[model samples]
Target: MTISPIAYDVQVHEYSIRVAGPDDLDSARAVMLDTVYRDFGTGYVPRWHGDIIDLHSAYVAPVRHALLVAVDERDEVVATGALDSRGPAHPPNPRWLAERYPSGETAQLRRIYVRSEHRRRGLARRMVAALLDFVAADGGYRCVYLHTDPAVPGAEDFWRSQGVAVCDEREESGQRVVHFEIPMPVTSSPVVVM
Candidate 1:
């Protein structure tokens, strides 16, 4: 499938988006760890000495995951998101999902982060739409699910704007988790150019 490159605002910095591979893992991990530290502040502990070595190792260990990165013209990683081919692990109690999802063929959208300086340029929304389009065109995923901390205020609304609906809510690991899901729309076959 040919996914067209999206146009950017003239005022925005020039950047490129691509599917990240092994070579980009170090930069990706640094972006992830730095964002985590910035968000968590002094409370950030050294998860593997707060280094990209171990973090990149763990991220690359997953088999069914896709990591995409957006880099500025200077080739510096600016934003990242990890898309998993499976939904959240089945809730310990199946009944917990009775009111919402009736199936498990969903993708997990995790670790979606954009640098503070790049937050309002529509980068996050573009990244998300690109990820969803990727999953939909791949033909197996039917939905995308994610959890966000509501204390951030705008997060819930941000996901909502992306067509994600809150399906459940709960607290875990000291954070208020708001579960959100977006049903994948049926996509037409891509035009084959041979």
Candidate 2:
């Protein structure tokens, strides 16, 4: 099942949010890496970014996973969001929390990033809606889970506005991570622009 593209009018230009294909790998990777390096600074670690380096295997190729991108009128990718089939596990994530979302039944939101210049225009929310529509259409996901670093500007607030925060703790690296879960049976549908 395909979710219709969502269109947004930001200033005078238009943007479209839709599932990304193989052709989008470079731009989407660039957007994610740029955001990570720029926002994460010296805290960046390549080990944690293996997924971004191999976008196809991590997202596009997976039957249950999806990577959504928001592009401008020129078709330049400005933002990206993704859903992964894996649930958070121990070490980085507490086992108790991880158990709540089984591998096949959970949709984990990841790498939600919007270019600094293109934010505050509802791009993220629209992409999220598109992803949720994908999950709801798949009919396999029982819960939606995500973790965000509070260090990023507006990250905590954004997740708070979208889902319920069930865990808030500092990781071994002393970074504060907020875990959120969007209730199941997501009823959001894509708003197509004619």
Candidate 3:
């Protein structure tokens, strides 16, 4: 499933979207954790974000997984989006939702975050498009799945624009979760940075 890395550059302010490397570990982690803590509350790690402990192991090392980063002109990481081989847990999630996508066939989109200062300029969308392209090129995934909290401002709406919501329910923790499924071989071309 390994292929040459994908990279895209936008000319406006010289931001680039590309496959993350070892050098990006720290900045990528900061962008992810800052977004999560800002939106999902502080001290929510391990339970909700154990993967951040070692992003390279969770998203970069696996042949079927990927971590993409959006870096600004200064080469500072501003956003991150990753593809994970694991699917949602059954007992914690719905059996139907979990069964439809086995781990091997699913690409669970995770850590799609854009720094607050960098939002609304399509960085997130471009990163997601690149991630989708990576999955399509890998040829091992049948579908891309993701779950997001409605509490995060505009998160549900942004995902609604990208994929179809297969399940929207309230979890035992009383948190509303919306699960989305994106079709394979992305029908629309991802936005080129140019």
Worst ten in a row by lDDT for model 2: 4-13
Q: Which stretches of candidate 3 lie over 4 Å from their true place?
A: 5-13, 171-174, 186-194
- TM-score to native of every candidate shown: 0.72, 0.86, 0.88
Estimate the overall C-alpha local distance difference test score of candidate 3: 0.81
**Pick by lDDT: 1 or 2, better one:** 2
Question: Which candidate achieves the best TM-score against the true structure?
Answer: 3
lDDT of 1 by residue, 1-194 (tens): 43322221222357677767667777887777776577634334563224344544443454345567788878787888767654544543234543344434666676677888778877777777766765665566666777666656367789877665554355333435667876675674543433
lDDT of each: 0.62, 0.81, 0.81
RMSD values for the candidates in order, in angstroms, are 5.4, 4.4, 4.1
| Pairs with steric clashes in candidate 1 | none
Give the per-residue lDDT of model 3 (tens digit) for 69-132. 8888898998898988889988788898889988988989999999998999898888788788
Backbone clash count, each prediction separately:
0, 0, 0
User: Residues 19-77, candidate 2, lDDT per residue (tens digit)?
Assistant: 78778889999999898889866444776778998999999888778888888989899
User: What residue runs in model 2 are displaced by over 4 Å at the alpha carbon?
Assistant: 1-13, 42-44, 171-174, 187-194
Candidate 3 backbone overlaps, count: 0
As for candidate 3, its clashing pairs are: none
